[model samples]
Target chain A: MAANRSIDNFWAVIPAGGAGTRLWPLSRAGAPKFLHDLTGSGMSLLQETWARLAPLAEERFVVVTGRAHRAAVTEQLPSLGPGAVLAEPSPRDSMAAIGLAAALLERDDPDAVMGSFAADHVIADHEAFSESVRVAVDAARADWLVTLGIEPTFPSSAFGYIHLGEDLPGVTGARAVRAFVEKPSTDVAEGYLATGAYRWNAGMFVVRPGVLLDLLARWHPEFAAALRAIAADVSLLEELWPTLPKIALDHAIAEPAAEAGRVAVVPASFAWDDVGDFDSLAGLLDRSGAGTTVLGDSSLVRVFESSGLVVPRSGRVVAVVGLDDVVVVDTPDALLVTTRERAQQVKEIVAGLRDADRHDLT
Target chain B: MAANRSIDNFWAVIPAGGAGTRLWPLSRAGAPKFLHDLTGSGMSLLQETWARLAPLAEERFVVVTGRAHRAAVTEQLPSLGPGAVLAEPSPRDSMAAIGLAAALLERDDPDAVMGSFAADHVIADHEAFSESVRVAVDAARADWLVTLGIEPTFPSSAFGYIHLGEDLPGVTGARAVRAFVEKPSTDVAEGYLATGAYRWNAGMFVVRPGVLLDLLARWHPEFAAALRAIAADVSLLEELWPTLPKIALDHAIAEPAAEAGRVAVVPASFAWDDVGDFDSLAGLLDRSGAGTTVLGDSSLVRVFESSGLVVPRSGRVVAVVGLDDVVVVDTPDALLVTTRERAQQVKEIVAGLRDADRHDLT
Candidate 1:
C-alpha cells in the first residue's frame, strides 16, 4: 500500500525483443529498439525499464530475451544474477516469451506474483506508474489477471482499447474489464473516447505465475504443459521453445479471460508511450510537440526553420534546413530520411532491404 | 567558320572559381562545385568543361583558379601543359580572373580571340554550343565583345537578362546588345521572357584579348593597366593582383561597352544550366524532373514514392520515403537534408557553420 515501499512476493518479468522495423537505421534487427536509448536518457530502454521496476520488485527480476541478445541484456544489467536471464533459441511471440518467465517463476517461488512489462516502453511519471503496478499486484494476489490500462490521451487508432466495467468489489482502484477491442478506425476511436470507458491497452499485465499458467492451460493445455516442462528441465528449452505456438498473450489468455469475467483493469493516468514510430518518438522526446528534437548528441545536429526529429548517431554533422516535420536517422552505414506523417512507412524500407538480401542494413 | 573544325587563333579561357555555398557539404571551400561530378558522369565538372572545349581550342586552353585549387585543376586536366594552369593568389572577382587570362593570351599570340566560359555550366547540345562559339568568335575577330545569349526556356529570376538590339549586318547570328539587366523579380523575369528580344546572359564572352582590355581601358583604365603589367612581368602577379579592382566582367566592361554600342550578342539556342543550387542541379540531372535522381553511386540509394535529388557521396545507403522534391546530400563529414524549394537557403546553413567555427564541415 505504501508507494515508496517494495511490494512483497513481486517478480518483475521483462520481455526484451522486437526489431521495431518502423524505426530503421536507428533500430536495426541486430540492435533493435529495446537496446537503444531512444529517450535520450543516457540509459537504454531496457536499462530504464529495469531501473523503474527494481524499486517495486527488489532483486526479484527475470529477463527473457532472444539468444542473440541475452549477452547484451546481461551486460547492460550487471547487477542481475547469471540465473535471472533466460535466453530463448528462437522467437515464438509473446505467449512463449512471457509464459517461459511465468513457468520458471512458478517453480522458483510459490508466492511470486509476476508483473510482465515490455523493455522498450517509456513512462513519464514513474511515481504514477509505480502506484498502478502496486494496485495491479494487489488484484493479482486475488487470483485475477490484471492489466495496467493507460488513460487515453488522444483518439489514436494505433493501439487497442480496453473497455472498463464496474469497479471490483474488494480491490480499490481495480475494475472488471468489459472487453478488449482490437485497433479501430479514427472515427471508432473518437466514439470510444466520447464514452469515457476506454483506456489504451499497453499490454502490461500482472498475475501470479501459477495463475497465468492455469489460465493458459484452460485455453491450450499443450502450450502451458510445454512451458512447464521446459522450466522443469532447462536443457529442453531449445527443442521446446520452437514447438510452442507463436501467439500473443492477449489472444491466448487475456481476451478469453475478460469474456469469462476474470480480467481486471487498473486505469492509470501516467503518460506512457511504446514509441511505435518516429512520430511517436518525437512526441515523447519533445513534450511541447513543436520544433526540431535531437535524440542523440545535440551538438551533432544543426537545424534551421525545421520541426521534427533527428537521430544523429554516425558522429557526423546533420544540417537540416527549411523542412517541416522531417525525420532523419543517420547511422554509420545507412541513413533514413522521411516525414513524421510517413513514419509508419519506414517498415516498408526495412522489408525491402530484407527481400533484397541486404540483411546487413536491415 | 566550320563547327567541326578548330577555329584559328582561338583560346579557351576557363574561369574556375566560386565556393558554391548553396551546394554545401557536397561543394565545400576546399572542394568547390567545379571539382565535383554532379552530373552523374565519371568526370568532374572541370573535366567535362575541358572535354567540351578541347575540340574547338585544341592545345590553346588556359585555366585560371584559386591558389588552393590549382593542383586539383591541373590533376583533372593532365593533358594541359605546365604553363597552361594559372593560379591566383586570392579571389579578386571575375574581372581579375578573366582579364589576367586575356592579358596573357594577348601577349603570347597577337591574333588571339579568347572565349571565356565558366568551368561549372552544363551544356546539352554540343554541336549547337560549338556553332554559337564559332559565330561569337567571328564577331570577336571584328573587335566586338561578343557574348553567347542563351534562348530563354522559362522566366528564371536567378540569372541576368540581355536586351537585344538590331542584328549585325555583316555577321550572321549576331545582335547588338541594347543593355544588360541584373537579376530581377519573378514578375520582372516573366515580362523579360514574354519579350522576344530578351535572352539569358550566361556570362559566356568571346572577344579579341586586345579588344577586351581596350574595352576595360574605356572605363577602368587603371584596372586594365594593372592586369597588363602583371602579364608583362609574371613575378609581379601576387603583388599587383591584390591591388586590382574586385569587379565582375559584366559590370566592368559588358555594361559600359553595351551602352557605347560596341558589345554584340550571339542568340544561341543550346540548353545551358549553371546549376546554381540543388533545385537547379535536380532539374539539370533529371530532365523529366518527376522521380528521385541519384547523383553518385546510384546503387547506394534506395527510394520509395519520393522525388528530388540525392547525392550519396559517403558510400552510405541512403533511404528516402514519401517525400516530395527533397534534397539529401550525404558527405563523409556532414549530411544535408532539405527540400528543393528551400535548396537556395542551404547557403544559410553553410554560413552558420562558418560562424560557429565549424569550417571543417563547411
Candidate 2:
C-alpha cells in the first residue's frame, strides 16, 4: 500500500437501509432516517454526510439503501449518478450492506480504501470529522482496519464503548483497540467515562475491500462465503441480494478485527452525534433548561422552564408547560410526546401505530 | 296577568351576538364562544342553551346574532327558520340588544312573556331551570322584572352577586332584589357566601315587551330614545345600529331596577355554569384530580399525574408529563400552553395576534 497516496483511491460507502424505528413518524418504512431533515437543516442527514465527504472523494461515493427509498436517496444526492443507488431487495443488516458496497467497489478498484458511514448521524465540527476520516483512511491504506472513535461527552449507556490500547506503531494520533464493550449499565457507563480510555463506537469504519474480505474469511467464514456468493452476482443485485444473511458489520467484522488486534482507533475530537434517539438530538439543539429545538417558524415555550426536549416542524408552534426531561414532537398528521429518557421507547408508538394498522402514521 | 299560563307562552330569546374576548384561540371573532363544542358532546354551547330552553318554551325561539354569524346561527339551530335568525347590523351592548328584541316582539305579540338567555351558559338541570323560568315569567307578567339568581356554588369573585329580599307577592318562588353587587373582592365573595343571601346573577331574565319598554323609558331615557329611533327605521338598521351605545343590560337596567326596588329574583336551584373561561370548562370536563378532556380521537396522558387540563382537538394527542394546573391546546397553526388559571388570559393571546395583524387566528 502506498503512503500519502492521492484521496482518489478513497471511496465513501453510506449504508442507508436501516429501518430506523427510533426516529418514527418522521422516518418511515418508505423513507428511512437518512433522507429526513431532522435538524431542520436544509440538507438531509445523508446529504450532509455526502457534502462532508464529496470534496475529498466526489466520484467515488456510493449509497446502499432499500429498494423502497432508492428514488429518495438518489433525489437527495444528485451528485450521485443513476448507478450510485445500490438497491437492496430487503434489509439485511450492516454486514450485508457493507459487503455489497465493498464487492461493488472491487470491480472498479480492488485495493480501494472504503469508509463506511451511517446515514443518520450528525457531525457538527465537519473540519474535525474530515480530519479524523483522513487519518483513518491513511491507516486503512496501510492494511490497518480503522474505526473512528468518538470521544465521550456524557456517560451514555446507549452506545458501545471502545477501550483504547497502546498507540499504533506507524499511525500517529491513533491507538490499537484493546476491547469492544456492548452497551453498559449507567454505573458501568460512569466508570467507563471516569477511566478515560473508552470512546463511543460511532459504527463508522475504514478498510480496504481486499483486507475486509480476507479478515471476514479468516474470522467469520460463513458470512464471508455469503458475501462472496452475493458479490459474484452483484450486478444482478435484485436476484441475489435477498439471499445474503443479515448481520451487522460490527458483529461480523469489527469485533473480530478488534479481537485480532488489527483494529486502530482514530480518536475523533469532533462533535459527532449519532442522533440515536431524541436524547442525542437534544444535545445538538440550542436549548435552555429543557432541550427544545424549534425548526422553521416554530416556537417552544417552556412554562415550568424545566429540562425537556421539543422538536416542532416549520410553521408550527409547540408550547410545553410544566414538563421536565420530556420530548414533544409536532408533525402535520401526528404529535408525539415522550419523556427524554424514554425516547427510545418512542418505537412503541410506531409499533402501536402499526398494530392499529395505521400505516399512514407509522 | 295569567299565573297558570302554558310554559310555551314564554318564548326563549337567546342573544348569541357577544364576541367575548375571554375565550380566544378556540373562540374567534368569526366563530364566537357560543359555537364551540367545549363539552365534547357534539352539541355546541348555543345548541346546549337552546336544548335547555326548548322544552320550556314552545319552539318559539329567537336568536339575536351579528349579521356575520347569521348563517352559522341558523345552521346550528335547524329547527328555527329565517324568522329565528335576528341579524344585528353591528355589535351593541346587551342593553340595546335587549331593547331591539323587545321592540321586535312588541310588533308580534305585546303580551308574549320573553325569557332572555345568554347563548353560552350551561345549565345542568333542565327541569329546575324550566320551573324557575315559569316562576320568573309569571312574576314578570305582573310587572315585576325577574332575574334568575343562581345559588353560589363557591365563593367565586368572577360573577356579580344579587342580594335577595322577601318573597314577592303573587309570584310563588320569586323574591325582591335587595341589591346588585358588581364582581367582588375575594373577601367580599367569602362574606357574601357566608351570609347565604347572595346569588350569582345568572344573566337570565323574563319580562313582557310593554313593561320592559316602559321601565327602560323611565330609567334610561337616552338609551331608550336611541333604540326607539332605531326601531322606527326598521329597514335602516345598518345606518342606526352602529350608533347605539354599548351598555350592558346589567349596568343599564338591572342595577337601576334594583335601586328602584322594582327588580325581582327567582331563586333557581339548577346547576348553572357560566363556562366563561378555560378554568370553568376544566371543571365541567369529566375528570378527577388534574386531567384533561380530549374530544374526538385525542389522547390525554398525564405522566406525573399532576392536575392539568388539556383540551386537544379531534385527531390530536396531547401528553402532559410532569405538569400541574396547566392547559395545553394544540391546534393546526398554533399551540397554546398556559397555566390553568391563566387560561382566561388566552384572550391576551388573541389580542397579541390582533396587534400582530394576524386576523386569520383572531
Q: Per-residue lDDT tens digits of candidate 1, residues A270-329?
A: 999999999999989887978999988989999889999999999999999999999999
User: Worst 10-residue stretch by lDDT in candidate 1 chain B?
Assistant: B1-10
lDDT of each: 0.93, 0.77
Compared with the real two-chain complex, what DockQ does model 2 have?
Answer: 0.28
lDDT tens digits, residue span A205-279, model 2: 998987887888887776666666666765556766677676778888888789989999998898788777776
**Pairing residues by index, what is the TM-score of model 2?**
0.86
- Model 2 lDDT at residue B168: 94
Q: By TM-score, who's the top model here?
A: 1
Candidate 1 Cα misplacement greater than 4 A, ranges? none
DockQ of every candidate structure: 0.89, 0.28
State in Å the error of residue A240, model 2.
Answer: 6.5
How do the residues B1-362 of candidate 1 rate in per-residue lDDT, one tens digit apiece? 45589998999999999999999989999999999998878888899899999899999999999999999999999999979998999999999999999999989999999999999999868889999999999899989999999998988888899999999879998999999999989899899888888999999999999999999998999999998998899889878989999999999999999999999999999899998999999999988989999998888999989999999999999999999999999999999999999999999999888889998988
